[model samples]
Target: MPDLGKYADAVLSSYAVSLVLLVALIALSIARSRRVARELHEVEERVKHG
Candidate 1:
């Protein structure tokens, strides 16, 4: 990695914030996809029976 120590504390803080946000976003998207897949399966089952 580059020399993060050369930058000010604000820079380090910004990088930390960005990393957290990206991780959260990726996790949320994965959860959302799983939920959608489950819902889709339920809907398909209902259509097949009714």
Candidate 2:
């Protein structure tokens, strides 16, 4: 890791927070996508049969 001089703590903490938020966003997006896909599949099945 490069020396961040006197702002090491601040910079590192910011990076950690940003990384956590990014991971959370990705997880939420994937979950929403799966849910939407499942709903679409169900709708399609109903349309096809009924």
Candidate 3:
């Protein structure tokens, strides 16, 4: 907050966009990890039974 002066809008908007993208990336990664973990568990169960 140290006097962005004339470029305040541009700078703030960039920060907002960056934060949003970061959150979305994190969410997608967690979802993908969970899905892969579940699929691996299922495969392991099938192999054990077979």
**Of the candidates shown, which would achieve the greatest lDDT relative to the real structure?**
2
User: What 10-residue stretch in candidate 2 is worst by lDDT?
Assistant: 1-10
Residue-by-residue lDDT tens digits, candidate 3, 1-50? 68999999999999999999999999999999999999999999999998
Per-candidate TM equals 0.82, 0.93, 0.95
**Which ranges of candidate 2 are over 4 A from the true structure?**
none
Which digits, one per residue and each the tens of the lDDT, describe model 1 over residues 13-48? 998999999999999999999999999999999999
Better of 1 and 2 by lDDT: 2
Compared with the true structure, the alpha-carbon lDDT of candidate 1 equals 0.93
* Residue-level error in angstroms, candidate 3, position 41: 0.4
The CA root-mean-square deviation of candidate 2, after full C-alpha superposition on the true structure, stands at 0.7
Supply every candidate's count of residue pairs whose N, Cα or C atoms clash at under 3 angstroms. 0, 0, 0
Whole-model Cα lDDT per candidate? 0.93, 0.99, 0.98
Candidate 3 lDDT trough over 10 residues, lowest sum: 1-10
